[model samples]
Target: MHRVKSDLLSAHIGSKPSKTWRAICDGIDVLKQGLIKRIGDGATTLIWACNWIPRTGIFRPIASKVPEPPVLVSELIDHTSMTWKAELVRNCFFDFDSDVILQIPLSMRKQEDFWAWHHETNGLFTVCSAYRMLVETKKNREDYFGSCGNCSDVQRIQKEWKHLWRMKMPSKIKVFCWRLAHNSLPTGSVLKNKNLANTANCKICGAEEDTWIHSLLQCNISKCVWALMDEDLLDLLASLRFSDPKYWVSYICCNIPQADGIRILVTCWAIWYARRKAIHEGIFKSPFSIMIMINRLIEEFEFVQGIDFKEKDLYQEKSRTHNWIAPQNGLSKINTDAAIDRTGTKGVVAAVCRNDQGGFIAASAMVIPHITDPETLEAMACLEALAFAEDCGIRSFVVALDCLNVVKNIREMP
Candidate 1:
């Protein structure tokens, strides 16, 4: 399958091929569009046609006349110097294009040219990435060809994009809010719209439709939470008069105080959380309880972001920097840390025990093949540190970790 040429993607289609083979060939055609060259030796890639240049995506010829034979990517680079032949590149391509061509890094190991699936991180084709691309393509087509009446919805959502993304909150929370704004959230109304649910009525209240607006704004629980807000905020919220949750959120975020706007978002999420608990566990939390939960969460987030305390206050208090500190004279200080790649496919855990004089007594590093949660990785590091200390015959050592949650868990242990 890896040996199949991209140019023959269409030639094999509908040629009495097996269903699986046909599917594979069709998939190859899709990947070909996103296929890019990771310039190694650059010997096999065509200069003008290959998507090798990082910025331009694909190389384009500047001259009106075409070359008799296609220019190879290797022709632009001088193998002796291991750099671009600047004069040759300038003559063949435009200034900007030439600059982009020059920026392509030469391989350190001088490996052979390889095709990169630009959509994926590992430079390989994936069904999920291809499906996402197709979904985006279909959405673009609908946006261009669909009715003019729905354009207003798209426009309104576009205006809210900045407000949703720029808010000082976690990425997951922002994404959840964005989904809510688009009515793409997995609420009962959305599920019903998708024919996945029997009814759109709120499972908890049963009085109104479980739409984003009703769930987050008009529901009795949501109303009680909103009522807890300051009168000025309540007045501003009422004056907006927008029934759409997305517009309501956007307006409030734009007009109200930033902290209050974040609090409102937190409250909405809290209401959703309560509904989730009611659905999953049959244990419903009251509006006041949910409000308290939201406040606690906001307070925690504020403390993490350093918004709750001034620099002077932080300076006055004993701050624990994420570094190793010596224990008392006879005691040992064990410091543990873990590093996980962005993909979360692999993790590395390391721990070291040092004496009060700052001399490392013992150290151990382990490569974890697979680990998902970063907190879990930190916990693993701590556990390994403890084991290392025990094996080294150390007693009553001080353990230190940058992860406060892990430290809290340790403190709460029996």
Candidate 2:
């Protein structure tokens, strides 16, 4: 080990004056900058060369045009006590670098300088950090995404993520929009790329890749849906020409009025939904029917927004009779339900368990890929509730189900 270390230091760090070893020397020089000093006695670390700041990484402060002799970390600290020499630091560093250096508190006593990996938060060396350092140096770029030239637009798109959430829609719809913007929608092409599908063809038309543009705008089905809307709306959507979904969506959302933009978003989401129905459930709705549904939902939401919900709640309070019954002491009750598609090929089973006094406990939800029978779905929900209760270490729990036949079947079980 000693011989190996000697060979490496002599060949790279120290002088091995040969043209063949030039590349190795250059590599070692680049590697040295990635090493950060932990700031102890400050004797070994050079003030300008070493990276010591926790927040700023390895930023060198330039106070002079001509470089001077290297200053050691120890020279910046007062030897009488473990405190920074503010005057020396000010002379050597700019205000910001001096502030960062001074912010690093010294140890109770002087100790040996310790080196750490600057790229990682935990100060541990990792291959990932080494690869990143190499890539950054080779590319000679400081942008967040070093390799991609068009990353500036991507960064801009990220800023508008909040716009999707701001829309007056369900949380699920917002997530759908977010996924669409990211081009992460599990269309046929995406599924094929993931090896989950045999081909990248459109599930509805089986022509070309099921890209975001084709699935949402260019497909015959989508075109038919757009034809049902007003000519002005169709023109507005047609005017979008961006190949990237995020850029396209951002352009429309920012340029068009919010009301009209929301309608477009709703239509896009509905188109994706109809495609999913056709793919997973073998159920297809006509483009005209999909448009009607979208308009109905928008009108309903707008109408409900204008109504006095407080008065409706008051009326409900006066007429309400059905109420949840609490379980007995030392026992828990679980309510389970499944929301299944019309064709029964896909559904989500959810279970929520609560204590006797209705205090929240544990809950679980599972997405079933396929369940032919609705009754089987109810059974799966019951089983999911039991499994969740067991996982929570709840021994005594009553399983509640809305289906009476399911409840009777459970009671009749041995």
Candidate 3:
């Protein structure tokens, strides 16, 4: 039955004396049995056979039928196989294209099936080949075509260029890099050899020099600080045991609670702070001193957390002290302002008392230097005022602010 079908397709296509045509006719015979429903007329039979044969070898299906013998081998190849479709989907390899297809392979027709089969077969080689081709294509595109200047290298460049053109990089990568850059591990110098440096003497303690592993969690200094906190920084190190530095940074930042991590951050900060102080002050502080500083910071933070006072109390206390007392049962208001500049930021907190008669009794503003954000500055001002009011033994008051956000934020304070 197969032989008869082959002979019929060859006669309909042509008794072409070419190896290519003969092979194509055989393929057409196979496809015709499965694909074609009926070839009722001679011309129709020929058209049906040729359409199944891939005329151009480029995989494009021929829309126009040629009603002639010695059919263009190209037309048969184009109709049958989808080489051009494959080429287009593959983006001519990574060397030729630098962009990632935003759509998944399953979303595409031929490519979907191809990838499904490739995945089923565990064709890692083929998958890697395709990846390399894509990378090469992207490199060529960036080299010849205009490159996104911000992209430092081909690897950093993404395939979804069109989709991500307007969207900035997600905060994940930037935050990871920023955290890594800030933490220890010689920011500027590149360690030549990992194995050799891992065994080298410690730069600070005159003991074995710490490698990437030591600097992060294993070194004496780091361990000592952790021990002093009576907290297990080792658990954090264990969680990150298998991860790279970048992954470790992300894991730590994401997993640790804000408050608990603040302690860890301050501990690490104290370690580095003490190291710097030793060099600058020319007085080497013991590891105990570093631990003391960390404990002090934690205590100070705990103290602030325990305070309770209304924003109004701050205003009334200010008014009475200024010899400008407001009438009994009046509204007290507090104003917090934050100014940011390249040099630094300053937060000014002002308090005013108003009498039942709608007269201002007293007002005062004080600038707090070294504040970073307006929210923080406002919080600090309110906190300072609360402290001052409590010292003056004023129990009841109202806080007013031109900054609605600050007012809302403080009002929502738990």
lDDT of each: 0.71, 0.72, 0.43
Taking the tens digit of each residue's C-alpha lDDT, what string does model 3 give over 87-112?
A: 33233223222121111111101211
To one decimal, what is the Cα RMSD in angstroms of model 1 from the true structure? 14.0
Of the candidates shown, which would achieve the greatest lDDT relative to the real structure? 2
- Candidate 3 has its poorest 10 consecutive residues by lDDT at 100-109
TM-scores of the models, in the order given: 0.40, 0.40, 0.30
The digit string of per-residue lDDT tens for model 1 on 1-414 reads: 334455654456654677777778777778766777787777998766666764322334444232553378887767875666767776667675665566555532457897776665445677888887677557766866875244434434554688668777878678777777667867788888899989988887896478887787788878988898778667766677776666776775665666767777777788888888888799988878887887788878887775552123221325557455678888889888888766755677899888989997889998664353567678778877877887899997988888887777666544
Candidate 1 runs further than 4 Å off: 1-11, 14-20, 53-70, 78-103, 145-297, 303-414
Candidate 2: list runs displaced more than 4 Å: 1-158, 306-414
Sorted on TM-score, best first, the list reads 1, 2, 3
